[model samples]
Target chain A: MDTTQRTEQQRSADRRRRELLEAADRVVLRDGPQASMNAIAAEAGITKPILYRHFGDKGGLYAALAKRHTDALLASLRAALDAPAERRERVEATLDTYLAAIEARPQVYRFLMHPSDGAPGEQGFDVGKHSAPVLRRMGEELAQVIEERLDLGPGTQQLARVWGHGLVGMMHAAGDWWLGERPCSRAELVRSLADLLWGRLAAAGDKVGGPGF
Target chain B: MDTTQRTEQQRSADRRRRELLEAADRVVLRDGPQASMNAIAAEAGITKPILYRHFGDKGGLYAALAKRHTDALLASLRAALDAPAERRERVEATLDTYLAAIEARPQVYRFLMHPSDGAPGEQGFDVGKHSAPVLRRMGEELAQVIEERLDLGPGTQQLARVWGHGLVGMMHAAGDWWLGERPCSRAELVRSLADLLWGRLAAAGDKVGGPGF
Candidate 1:
C-alpha cells in the first residue's frame, strides 16, 4: 500500500462509484425507480458484493441516489435564482423550476421519499436521513438568497427560511397532485403558485413579521 | 335469490366489506403500508380468495384504502372549513386540521400517495382515481369560501381552486417533512402557512387577478 498504489486505488474507487451511480440512474430512468438492486448491478456489469461495498445496502444506494438528485435540484435552483430577474419574475422562475423538476423525475422522487415500507428489512430505512436534510439545506440556501433578493433586514433570515420551507412544501404538494391531472397550463400553474410567495413578501412591506401594521 | 334473503345478504356483505377494510388498516398500521395481502387476510380471519372477491385484487384493495383515507381527510377538512369562525381563524384552523391529519396517520397518507411500486401486480393501481376528485372538490369549496371570506369576484373561483390545491399540497409536503423532525410548534406551522394564503388574498384588494392594481 505505497502512496502511488493508494492514490491509484482511490482514483479507481471514485471512477467505480461514479460509474455505478450513472448505471443506477440509467436503470431508474428506463425501468422506473422500483428497479431492483439486481437490475442495477446487472446494468453496471458489476457483482452484488462490489455494489454493496460502495453503497452498503439498498438504503445506502437510495440515499446516494437521493443526494445526487437533491444536489442537482439545488444547483439548478441556485442558477435560476442567480439569474438577473425582478422579485416577481424570480419567484415564478424558482417555483416553476421546482415544479418541472418534480414533474420530470417523479418516479425517482417517489422512491426516495416513499420507499415501500412493507418490504422485509426495507422498513428500517430512515427517510429523514435523506429527505429532511434536503428541505433544511434548500431552505437555508433559499433564505440567504431570498434575503438578498428581497433586500430584507438581518432578522428576516428565519422568516425567509419559513417561507422557503413553506414554498418548497407547497410546490411539492401541488406538483404531486398536478402531475396526475394537469388541471392548469404550465404558465398558469407557475403564476398561481408564485402568487402566494410573492404576495406574502410584498404584503410584509419592509417588515419581518411581528405585531403587523 | 328471494328479496328478503338478498336484502339480508346485502347488509351482511356491506358489513364484511367494512370489516375487511378495518382489518387491512390495522395491518397497515401495525406492519407498515407494505403489509401484504396475506397479512391482511390473516388479520381478517379470511382467505385470499374471499378478499379478492370483495375487492378485485391487491390494486383494488389499495384504491379502496386510499379512497377511505382520502374521504376521511375530506370530511375532516370540510367540517373545519364549515365551522362558523372568522376568516383568519378559519384559515388557521383548516390548515391545522390538515397538518394534524397528516401527522396523525402519516403511514396511511404515505401509503395512499407513495404505495410500494415494486410489488408484483401492484403496479396497476390507479392513483389518480382517488386523489384528484378530492382536490377538485376542495378547490370548489375553497373558491366559494374565498369569495365570501376575501370578498373576491366570481372569476376568483379559479384563483381559489389554485389556492385550494396549492394550500393542500403545501400542507402535505410540509407535513410529510415535519412529521419526521417537527422543527416548529404545530401552532407556528399552521399560522405561517395560513399567512401566505391570507397575505395573497389581502394583496388582491378585491380584484380577480389580471394586473395593474
Candidate 2:
C-alpha cells in the first residue's frame, strides 16, 4: 500500500480499537466481565468478525481495555506528580486525582482491584503489575518530601511502601463505600483521608524514643 | 419441650451450624460462591435440610458466615485495644491483630471486599456495617493515645478514622497479595507497616503546633 493509504488504514484501526475499549468499559460496568464479546462489538458499532480480527478473543479484548485504562490512569497520576504545588497541596492533589479516577470508572477500578481467578482464558490483567509501579513512583515522590522534612534512615523505601499501601487502601475503601449508600461526600472523604495521613506524617519527627517521650 | 430436651437440641444445632460454616468457607474458597448448597451440606457431612434449617437460604448462610468472621475479627481488635502499650505501640498492635485476622481467613477477606450494587438478593456483602464500629472503636482508642501524647484540638476522632482506614487497607492488600504468593514474611510486612504508620504518626504531630510541645 502507498504511505497515505497505510497511514489511513492505521488511523482507522486505531479508532476502532479505541471504540472497542470504550465499549468494553461500558459493557463491564453494566453487565460485568460476563458481558459478551458480540455485545461489545455491537455497542462499538462494529461486527463480531472485526472485533475478533482486532483482538483475537474475549480475553484479548478485556486485556486491551484494562491496559488502556491503566495507561490513562498512570498518565493522569504522573501529571499530578509534576503539577506545581507545596508538599501538602501536592499530596492532596494526587489523592483527589486518584479518587476522581476511581469514581469516574468504578467498574474498571473494580476489575483492576478484584481479579476473578475462575474466569477462563483471562490472563495478564494483574492490578499489582500496573499498580506497583505507580505505587513506587508515588512512594519515591513521598520519600523525597519526607526525607526533606525529616531524618529517616536507610529504610525509607520500606517506609514509603507502607505509606503508599495505606494511602491506596484508604482510597480503595472510600471509593468502595462511596459507590454504595454511604452518607459522606467524596470531598469530605478525601479531606478526612488527607488529614489522617498528613497528621501522622507531620507527627513522625517529634518523638523517636519508642512512643513515650 | 422439657428444658433438658430443648438444651440438647440447641447444643446439637449450634455444633452443626459451626460445622456448616467451616465447610462453607472451604467450598467458597475452592469453588467460589457458585458452590451448590447440596455440595456444602455434603462437605459438612450433613443433610441439605439441616443446612436450610440453620441458615434459611444460601444468602443467609453467606451472611451468617461473614457475620461470624467479622465478629471474631472485631473481638480480636478489641483485645488489642486493651493491651497496655504506648501510643505508637497500640497502633502497631492493632495493625498486627488486623493483619493476623485477615491472613487467617483470606477467603473471608475477599468475600467481604467484593463489590455490590446495594441491590437485594445480590450475593455481595457489606463490610462497612460491621467494620464501621470497629473503626470507631480503634479511632477512639487511638484518639486516647494521641490525646495523651499531644494536645491537638478535638480532631483526634477524625485523625483516628483516617488511621483506622489506612491500617485496614494495608492489611487487606497484604492479605490479598499474600494469599497465593509469599511476597514478604508476614512478620516483616506487619512490622514494616507498623513502622510506616507509627513513624508518620510520630512526625505528623510536629506540624500541628500542639500545646503539649
Candidate 3:
C-alpha cells in the first residue's frame, strides 16, 4: 500500500480504538471494577471475539482503560504541580487535583486502583498484577518532578524517589479511605493533608492528660 | 461430653490450628504469594484434606497466616510508637520497625499485600478481597494513637484518621519500592520519610534555573 493509504488506515484504526475505549469506560463507570467483557463488547457494538482481538483479553482491556485514566489524571496533576505558585500552594493544588479527580469519578478510581478479586465477572482479571501500575507511574512521575525542581543536596535523586512513592502512597491511601467514608469535606481533606506535609503533625501540642503523639 | 472433656478437645483443636498455620507460614515464606495448598499440606506433614478441614479453604488459611504476621508486626509498631521518647524518635522507630519487618521477610509481606492471582493453584484465591484488611487495620490502629495523643483542635479525629491512613500508605509504598530496589539503606529511607513528614518538602529550595517543587 502507498504511504498515504496506510496513514489513512492507521488513523481510522486509532479512531475505532478510541471509540471502543470510550464504550469500555462507560461500562466501567457503571459497573466499577467488575466490568464484564461481555458487557464491554455489547457496549462497543461488537462481539466478544472482536473485543478480544482488539484488546487481547479482559486484563489487557482493563490495563488500557486504566492507562487512559491514569494518563489524563497525571496530566492534570502535572499542571497543578507546575503551576506558577509557591511550593505549599502547588502542593495543596496537586493534592486537591488528585482528590477532585477521585471524588468526581470514584468508579474509575476504584477500578484503576482497587479492582476487587472474586467479584462476579472478574475472571481473567488479576487484581494484584494491575493494581499498582497506576500508583507506581504516579510515584515515578512525581519523583521526576521533585528531582527536577528541588535542590536536596547530596542523594537528591534517591530522596526524591522515596518521597515520590511515599507521597503518592499517602495521597492514595488517604483518598481511598476518605472516598469510602466522607468524614469531611474535600477542602478539609486537602488542608489536613497539606498540613501534615507542612509538619503540623510535629507541631501539634499534646492533648491534656496524655503524652504527645 | 463433659465440660472438662470439651475444654480439652477445644485446646487440642486450637493447637492443631496453630500447627497448621505454622506450616503454612513456612511454605509461604519459601514460595512467596503463590504458596499452594499442596505445598502447605506437605510442609505440615498432613494431607490437603486435613489442611482444608482445619482452615476451610486456601483463603481461610491465608487470612489466618496474614493475621498472625500482621498482629506480630503491629505489636512491634505499637511498641515503637509508644516508646518513651521524643515524637521524632518514636516516628523513626515505628518506621524502622515496619521497614525491618518487611525487609526481613519480604516474602511474607508480599504474600500478605501483593498476592498474585491467576497463577497455577490460585483458583479460589482473591487478592483484592484480602489485600487491604492489614493496611486498613494498621491505619485504624495508628489513627487511634494519633487521636488520643495529639491536640489538633476541632476535627482532630478526622484529621488523625486521614493522616493515619496517609502515613501508613507513605510508609508502605516507600517500603515496598525500597525493599525491591534497595536504593538506599533502611536508615536513609527512614530519615528521608521522617524528613518529608516534618515539612522538609515544603521547606525545600528550588533548583537553580527551575521552579521549585
* TM value for model 3: 0.88
Q: Which regions of candidate 3 deviate over 4 angstroms?
A: A1-5, A8-12, A35-39, A42-49, A117-124, A211-213, B35-53, B56-58, B117-124, B211-213
Q: Candidate 1 — which residues are off by over 4 angstroms?
A: A46-49, A100-137, A144-158, A198-213, B103-157, B200-213
Every model: iRMSD: 11.8, 11.2, 2.6
Superior by DockQ: candidate 1 or candidate 2: 1
Residues B1-213 of candidate 3: C-alpha lDDT, one tens digit per residue? 599999999999999999988888887777766666888889999889998888887778878888888899999999999998988999999999999999998777887788764364333345666778889889999999999998999989888999999999999999988887888999999999999999898888889987443
Candidate that scores best on lDDT: 3
- What stretches of model 2 exceed 4 Å from their correct place? A1-17, A30-60, A103-152, A178-188, A200-213, B1-16, B29-38, B45-58, B102-152, B155-159, B174-187, B199-213
- Two-chain DockQ for model 2: 0.15
**How much lDDT does candidate 1 score?**
0.66
lDDT of each: 0.66, 0.59, 0.85
Cα deviation of B126, candidate 2, in Å: 11
Ranking by lDDT: 3, 1, 2
Among the numbered candidates, top DockQ falls to 3
Candidate 3 residue lDDT tens string, A117-150:
4354234345666778788889999999999999
Worst 10 residues of 3 chain B by lDDT: B117-126
Error of 2 at B118 (Å): 25
Candidate 1 vs 2: which has more TM-score: 1
Clashes of each: 2, 13, 0
Q: TM per model?
A: 0.76, 0.66, 0.88
